[model samples]
Each structure stands twice: as structure tokens, then as C-alpha cells.
Target: MKILACYSIKGGVGKTATAVNLAYWAARSNYRTLLLDLDSQGASSFYFRIKAPAKKNLGKRFLQAYGQLASQIKESDFPHLDVIPAHLSFRNFDILLEDLGKRKNRLRQALKGLKKEYDLIILDCPPTISRLAENIFNAADIVLVPVIPTTLSERTFEQLLQFFKQQDLSRSKLVPFFTMADARKQLHRETAIAMRKRYKNFLQHAIPQSTDVEKMGKYRTPIDLFARNTQANRAYYALWRELEPQLKKA
Candidate 1:
């Protein structure tokens, strides 16, 4: 199974939306997909109209064994898609990870049991740099970060790069894409051009600021179902098409 994570040190960068939509595209392509919400706020679960898991202690259960984590999985509305709703207890992940000591691959080790069940696992990660983040970095085959084409976003992305360097992690697997971009804005357009020139690994697709994406809060489902013909929807599909080969190799 290929493990993909939506991760960024800064929140409100459209990471959750990117995760949700891409998982939808994967499942729609007939892949057995699992979207795991690891954020304490449970925005991913909320977006899917799913209630938080009653177990509430994902960290505790994750440490126990794969059985507990497997038991927590729920079926999503879309076909071929499954979800593991977030739990409030996930707030203790930093502490829990710290207590694990030298288990370098704790998350990846626990997830091995799912290899037979899922073709793809999309993790909607919490925004933070901690021990838990280290586990995620070790677990994922690729980390997808949503970067708004702005100075603040670029700074954080650089910080993430610096962190990756310090940890001796491979930066090649990181795919940074522009989100909430508006071509009408000169600053946005210039930033995109500059980023593309500076980072050869950057994705070509960009999700423009769309009214349809904002409406996801009201529909509680991927915008593709409601706005399939829209530009934003097309951009999302283009993104998956580009990543399809990479995912296959993974």
C-alpha cells in the first residue's frame, strides 16, 4: 500500500481540503482508499459528516496494536473509501510519541497490518512539528503540502525544508502545490511563477480560489460531486492525473 500524507507546519493552508479531494479522486478510480484524520480538531471528520470516534484515544489505541486502529475505521459515503475519524485524545500525540522512545517506525510499523486491505492510505495530519510529525515523516512515502502563493507560505515551506534537512529526510518526496490562488492578483501570479522557477519539484496544478470549494462546508462532501464541471474540480483531477504514475511506483 502507498501511504500519502497531507502535512504542513502551518495550518489554514488548504491541507485538509487537498487531502479530502485527492482521496475522493483515488477512491473514484476504484482504489481501496483510507483517509485517516489525525488532527485533534477533527476538521476532516467534520467535512465528511462523520462523528469523532468514541474511543477518543487514537494514540493509546495506535500503541496497543493494529486491531484497535482497524476497529476504529468507518465507511465513507463515497465508494471504495474508508475513514478513521479523529479523536480528541489525539491531542496527546506529542506526549505519546515522546514516551515511545526509540521506536523510529512506530506509525509505519502499526500500519503494516493494513497493507492487505488498502491500495492507498491518505493521512490528514495535524499541523505541528513534534515527535508525532517525525513518525509521520518516517511513515509516508510522499508528503503533500498545500502552499499558498504568498510570502508567509514560502517562509513556512522553507522552514519545513530546513527541518527536513536537519532530520536527514529525503526532500524529493515532498510535493508542494499552490492553493487558493487567484490569477487576477499580480502578487499571486508572480509568486507562482517564482516558485515554479525556484523549485523544480513543484506541482504544475494549482487550485484557484473557488466558490465551490468554500461550499464544501455546507455539503459536507467533495466538491467534485457537486461541481464536477467547474475549473476548481478540473484542477483537482489534473493533479491526480499527474501524481498517478508516482503513486503507482510507490
Candidate 2:
């Protein structure tokens, strides 16, 4: 399976939204997709209307019963897409990961059994640069870095690049995309131009800021499903098209 991790060091940049929409599009295109909500806040799980299991020590339970992760897949109702919901238990998962001493590969080891079951596995990562995030980088085939057209977002992009440079990875697999963009803003226009000039070949499609995107969480549906005629839907469709060539090769 091809693993795509939608991530950002900073929050509120639409990483979860991108993951949800892309997974939905992948399923709609006839691919068997799996959306793994890795964020502790459970926002992605909430967006998909999946209820997270209640328990304070559930992350510990998960690690102890790692083999059961696959069994949980049978409970989801989306035809071609399955979801692994996140729970509040993950708030303490980081501490457990640290105590385990090999935290960087914890997620990688947990996901090895699922490689053959999905055509595309999208990870909705938490907004942090922890060992869990590094594990995601190590496991992902392609890392889609979402950046807003702002100075703070640009700084995060640079930090991402620096992080990648320190790791052993295929640099060509790093794809950058603009998220929550307002084209009419001078800062947005300037930032986009600068990003294109610096990372021309690695840049993917840009997703403009729209209310439709924000509403995906409220509707508990993807933009493609909720408002197909809107600009947001078209943008996500274009992103899927752009991603097709790379996905097919996997």
C-alpha cells in the first residue's frame, strides 16, 4: 500500500481537512482507502462521525493489543474507506512511547500488517514534532506538507525541510502544497510566488480558503461529498488528479 501522511508542524493549516477529503476522493475513485486518525484531539474521527472508544489508558491498551487494530477495521461503514478512530487516550500515548524507548518506530511497527489491505493509507497526524511525527516521516512513502500562505507557515515549511534534511529519506517524495490560501491577499500572493520559485518541481496543487472547507467538519463529510459544485471541491478534485500519477505507480 502507498502511505501518504498529511502533516504540518503548526496547527490550523487544514492538514486534517486535506486528509479527510483526499481519502474520500480516493475511495470515490474506486481505491480501497484507509484514514488513520493519529491526532490525539480526535478531530478527524469527529469529522467522519466515528466515536472514539472511551478509556483513560486506551493507548496503553492499543499497544498491548496491537494485533487487534486490524479487527477494528471491520466495524467501519464506508464502502471503500475504513477509519481507525483516535481517542483522548492518545494524550498520554506520547509518554508511553517515550517509556518504550523505541518511540520513533512504534507507529511503523503497528502499521506493517495493514500494508496489503489498502490502496492508499492516509494518516491525519497531530500538530507536533514529536517522535510519533518522526515515525510517520519514516513510514510514509510520500509526505504532503500543507502550508498556509503566511510568514508563520513559511517558517514551519523551512523547519520541515530542515527536519527532512536530517533524516534518511527520498527527497523527491516530499510534495508541498498551499492550503487555506486567499489569493486576493498581497501576502498570500507573494508567499505563493516565493514558494513556487524555490520549490517549483515539488509544488502540488493549491487549495484556496473557503467556507465550504470549514463546513466539512460540521457536516461530518468531505468537501467532495458535501459541496461538489463549489470551488473547494474542484480544488480537491484537482489535487486528486495531480496525485493520481504518483499513486498509480505504487
Candidate 3:
């Protein structure tokens, strides 16, 4: 199975939106897609209208009962795509993973049994460089880094590259893209130009900032399903097209 993680060191850069749209495109293309919500806030789960179970102090129990957690994920109410909903229980995941002394491979181990069931797996990661994040990096075939066209966002992209370099990973797997772009702003234009110049081959299609993308939250649907005619939807379709060959080969 092809595993892709949509991630960013900094939040509010449309990582969840990218994951949701990409998962929808993969499923629409007749691939068995699964989107795992790894963020404790559960935004991806909420966007897909999957309500996480209400319980406290369940994180430790979940790690101890990994099989049951996997089963619950498989039985969740997502149509063509399966969802592994995240809850408040996930907040302590980093601690549990570290305590187990399998910090770097915890997520990879948890996902071992799911390889045969999905053609594509998209992980919605939280914005941090923790052990869980390292596990995601180690497990994914590709890490899709979404950055807004700003100096701070560009710095975050550089930090991500530095992290990858430290891990001794191939830079080819680091696909960076601009999200929430506004052409009217000079900084956005300048930043895009700089990024294209520095990481030409690593750059993917840009996703423009649009109200339609934000509306997906209220609609609880992917942009492809909610507003196909909108600019955001078309942008995501372009991004999906760029990703198609890589996914198929994986």
C-alpha cells in the first residue's frame, strides 16, 4: 500500500484540507483509500463527520488494545474510504510511544496489519516534530508539506528539509507546495518565486486560498464533493493529477 502523510511543522496551513481532498480523489479513482486522523484535535475526523468516541484516559488503554482500536477504525462510517478517528485520548500518544521504547517506529508498527487493506493511506499529522511525527516520516512513502506563501512558512519548509537531511532520507520524497496563496500580496509572489527557484523539482501544484476550501468544514465534505466548480476544487484536482503516477507506482 502507498502511505502518504500530509504534514507541516506549523499549523493553519491547510494540511488537513490537503489530506481530505487527496483521500477523496484517491477513493474516487477507485482506489481503496484510508485517511488516518493522527491529530489529537480531530479536525480531519470532524471534517468527515465522524464523531470520535467520548472518553477520558483512554490513550493508555488504546495502546494496550491496539487491535481493538484498529477494528473500530475499520468499522467507522466512511463510505469508500476508512477513517481512523482521533480523540482527546490521542493527546497522550507521544508519551505512550516514548514510554514503550519504540519511539521512532510506533506508528509504523501500528499500521503493519493495514497494508493489505488499503491502496492508499493518508495520515493527517499534527504540527510538531515529536516522536510520533518521526514515526510518520519513517513510515510514509511521501511527505506532502504544505506551506503558506510567507517568510515564516518558508522557514518552516527549510526546517523540514533540515530534519529530513538529519534523518538521511532522500530529498526526492519531500514534496513541498504552496497553500492559501494570495497573488495580490507581494510577499506571496516573492516567496513562491524563491521556493520555485530553490526547490523546483520538489515543488508540487499550489493551492490558492479560497473561501470554498474553508467552507468544507461547515459542509463536512471534501472540496471535490462539495464544490467541484470552485477554484479550490480545481486546484486540488490538479494536485491529485500530479500525485497520481507516484501513488500508482507505490
Listed per model in order, the count of residue pairs whose N, CA or C atoms clash below 3 Å is: 0, 0, 0
Q: Which residue pairs of candidate 3 clash?
A: none
Our tally of clashes for model 2 stands at 0
Superior by TM-score: candidate 1 or candidate 3: 1
Residue 199 error, candidate 1, Å: 0.9
Please list the residue runs of candidate 1 whose C-alpha ends up more than 4 Å from where it truly belongs after superposition. none
| Tens digit per residue, CA lDDT, model 2, 92-125 | 7678877778757777777777878888889999
User: Which candidate tops TM-score?
Assistant: 1
Please provide TM-scores, in order, for all candidate models, with all chains considered together.
Answer: 0.97, 0.92, 0.92
Q: After superposing candidate 2 on the true structure, give the runs of residues whose Cα lies further than 4 Å from its correct spot.
A: 74-77
TM-score of 2: 0.92
* Top-down lDDT ranking: 1, 3, 2
- Candidate 2 Cα lDDT to native: 0.81
User: What are the per-residue Cα lDDT tens digits for candidate 3 across 29-98?
Assistant: 8778888898889998988888787766666666555575566574334457888888787777788888
Off by over 4 Å in 3: 55-58, 61-66, 74-79
Choose the strongest candidate by lDDT.
Answer: 1
